[model samples]
Target chain A: MLGVTLSRWTMSYFAAALAALLAGEVLMTAGYGFPSAPLRAPETLVVVHVVAIGWLSLLMCGALFQFVPVLIARPLHSNTLPLPALVLLLAGLGALLAGFLQLAGTLDPAPPLLPVAAMLLAGGFALALYDLARTLWPAQPLPLPARFVAVALFFLATTVTLGMLFSFALTTGLGSRPLLAVAGAGLPLHVVAGLGGWLTLAAIGVSYRLLAMFMLAPELEGTRSRAVFWTGTAGLALTVLGGVAALSLDAALAPALIGGSVLGVVALVLYGADIVHLYRARKRRIIELNSQMAVFAFAALAAAAALAVTLIVLGRLSEQVGALVFLIAFGWLTGLGLAKLYKIVAFLTWLECYGPALGRVATPRVQDLVVEARARTWFLLYYLAVASATVALLMAHVLAFRLAAGAMTLATLAIAAELIRARRLVDVSAEIRLPAGAQRPHLLMSVPHPSP
Target chain B: MTQDYLDLDVRPILRDGGEPFEKIMEAVAALAPDQGLRLYATFKPIPLFQVLGRQGFGYAAREIGGGDWEVLFSRADIPAETAPAATPASATPSAAGASDWPAPVQEMDNRELEPPEPMVRILAAIEEMRPGEVLSALLCREPMFLLPELEKRGHAWRGGFEPDGETYKITVRVGETGDKA
Candidate 1:
């Protein structure tokens, strides 16, 4: 049956993300065994990669799989490839996280597997890109949000390639004094690709449409919206290129790094302000849990960027700076991502099951899927955990850090459980069913809740 | 006689937006003595279409394709002739001017004894059907933009083509009862 197949890309991405989460847990647990040294450790790098590449990357891809069609005003390009793509990404993530965990240990079997796993992940992404690109390719002068997503795909591709390059370098055991040190140069490139190009840009584009729809505000178009896209795009490109050059060419690229960072910081500030403006202008007075939690994450991101800029100017990218960067990347960016996922999963399930019956018959509102009050509390607890971890990491308190990690794990698990409940996968089917005791309300579709 | 209504150009003056709209409205306002101007404008949202109806501009709006509407407007404040004329064309005053209408709406002006086939195609599908049936076809990818012509002819309905997250089946109905299911 040509039904709405579960998106292969989404499945794969989620699988990888779950594997990464498990790896993070394992690394934290292992910390208890190896308590001598924790800073700049291999295990730490493994945990970071698991969260960055494995977790967040998948989450973004899965979301795009669902949301892109809605944005473009079309059905998904293809439903056929989701399962294969999901399997490939899941297997790749499994191998990749395993390799990282092995590398973290004293004796390593991770080296050989890294390149293979990278290739598999890259292949999975490539297939997904092709499918998504089909949706965008035919449109003349693609819409604002879609354009951002299209361009972000390129950055995603670049990020994957750079990730592979780093894996190759590690596998080959390049000396500390190599002419072109891929690992050293590629780390910042990965950060740029993920944080600026993929997450920030994609998030802005999505927020423009979603926020407006949610808030019942005017469309986020016209000159200022365009400026946000171009400025953010240019800034991220410049910063990534400049940082890469600085590493490869020493003082020769110092000017580029300085200029790029400034541009990047400026763009980020504008984006932050824009998000705040959107929230402020919202017609809905009471903010939902996803949006409310996202505001703190957004603030943390902007603050971290500002702090990083200051530290870089004063030449203080020491362990403390690294810890802060970790918090922003994982705690802020990933936390916001998780919060948003809770809403998205529920919303999509509603569309799949209840969207068709809106005109013909009565259906339950999206609110019926989950309890909002509980969601708000979970979000608050998640942020609390993030804040405590950040402080513990700063103070170099190992015991406190572990406890905070446990708290984060609990919060994330709770949110994931809530997502499953919202989806009601066990209950959803092709049959056009109505909620119990429902009458055909007037043809007006109730508005889905917006971000704060 | 068909040639007379075939050339009737409609220009609506938008409240104050652009030439096409405003000119169209002005053209509609300046109807020939004893002749009504039929203005066709698509309304994708039924609520907005109904709002226009409440504002004294009567029309017959039908969902022809996608979420698009084909609403028909007349210069007079009265609703567009909802029921097709049962009498011979020679007897109806508007039928005498049917020849002056645009080609598509006037294609059947020669045979006034029967309802305009295109108008019949548009209105026959929607009249007395459920609101959901009307809206299902309205929101399709290839929305019924021609529905405006129907509204311009003076039909009324409740509600809009809401994105209620519902899926409706839209297809060509082959019978007079307007039953698609």
Candidate 2:
């Protein structure tokens, strides 16, 4: 009953984004950063954008395109926005990554391309936000999903604006301000908005409908989901605003800044609790590969949050290590998203083709799409690679970190392959179709009918 | 005669509807037989069952699958002493009019102005009506699929079921001027 239609294009954008990152990984492996690279290396920016814009952003946008309508029980205001959004974002992201790569080695004329690309990416995102907003306009008194979407929009705006500002500031050498004077000044804000607001909030909203609908669990009721929403939202807002102010040396507001973080922690905890509750009530005994593997991302967030809080309290939050947290959140959430998309695409394909023939003719079961057990192995390895990378970066083991990054790249490539297979890209329907003389049995029939 | 019963598969008989069920019911009555001929279908049209049962075709149903059911109907007056033939043993058969059978419960309840108690009363009213049967106070919410389901079942409601504040009520008048019935 939903009218979102951007999955195919979004997956393509996702694929392109991963390809760019894998290319960057190759560059880094070839002694590109051999001479004690700065913590905020340009190559790092390339990897960051690949994970952020390429994987997580693409996954989030595609999923929202497919899912938001179902959450609101309404269709998108217009179906045409996704195509342009996909094209503009992918092109802009490609340009921006190339600019970052060029800057990493030696400043080139391509530096000017950064702002241009950022503007295009921002414009694309703005259009998406507009389309989504208009569609959600008549949603009648706003549900919890709408609330989450609203917050995610705000974060999207902030992240894009901050990203653009950073892009411009990189060229102008606005090194007077302490935070701006630092190499990776706006990293924390970008991380907070992109990870906590955009990815986390959107994922939560999407999960509410998806998990319940597929598992046949009852609709979420009471104030718990709402509480999680408000807490996460308010916490992130405080954390972002406070961190920004503190960076600007607003020492008076530092306590409020800390308070905001504490609230964010509370929100994450509440969100974690809600997820557990959702799983408990689920009717589907077996959670498919996506959700089972996705829990690590959630765990990583909670764990990273605790570590961040400790570092903040101790007054020793390192910029480089904070970057690592960004990696974990982006990698894990995006990885889970890409993994889940494999199943969703397969399922939607089945529904589109076979659903009408349900009682009229025999159809394959949903399980026939892919072997879940094998997919589960890839997911486990992906998470393991992420954990190792996070630990290696924290300990400042440069060689181990690069090795772990390669493993991560390989794992992600495997995930992409699995998604391609799940979509049945190589499989023909004719191969699986029943022969002409075969008797097709009803799925709901208790007795299996013998072939006539 | 018993061999005749063994040779007949009851599937086509009940699938043939009223006349066939009646003929089978008649044969059961003449049998002084062991068991009744049971008619089973996924949909249990209550009127058909009531007609056959009242006319001496005994039937019982047990749900076998989520929405599938098995119905068993046997002769009502089979001898207490005789172990009825595993197959039909009737030598002679009579005809059962079975025409006085009440219409389907849905048809009987069409006369109500307000929601009727026991609800099935609404069906009774509809069945009794010559042309217009009023079915009132049947709750229908989010009726897109439901209205179509009713239509597919040959039920027509003018302006369909509407809610009375929190609860819904409707009058479904079968055999209206345009109705096929």
lDDT of 2 by residue, A1-452 (tens): 32222233444544555565455455444434421366568866776676678767876776676566656656666666777887788888888887786686555764378888888899889888888788777886777877787789889888887787787787755555655632245576777788778877887777775665554354564588888888888888877766666666734445645676777788778777877877788755666666676667677776777777777777777654644454555455655575567667665454433332332334455556567777677777767776776776667677776776677667667766765664543343555544332232221111111212
Per-residue lDDT over A29-117 for candidate 1, one digit per residue giving the tens place of the 0 to 100 score: 45632132564566666666667666777677777776676566554577555556666777777777677666766456734788888
Docking class of 2: incorrect
Best model per lDDT: 2
Cα deviation of B93, candidate 1, in Å: 23
- The TM-score values for the models, in the order shown, are 0.67, 0.68
True contacts kept of 1: 0.00
Which residue ranges in model 2 land beyond 4 Å of their true spot? A1-10, A17-36, A105-107, A172-185, A242-253, A319-327, A425-452, B1-70, B73-181
* Deviating ranges (above 4 Å) for candidate 1: A1-19, A22-26, A29-40, A105-111, A173-179, A245-254, A425-452, B1-181
Each candidate's chain A: what TM-score?
A: 0.84, 0.84
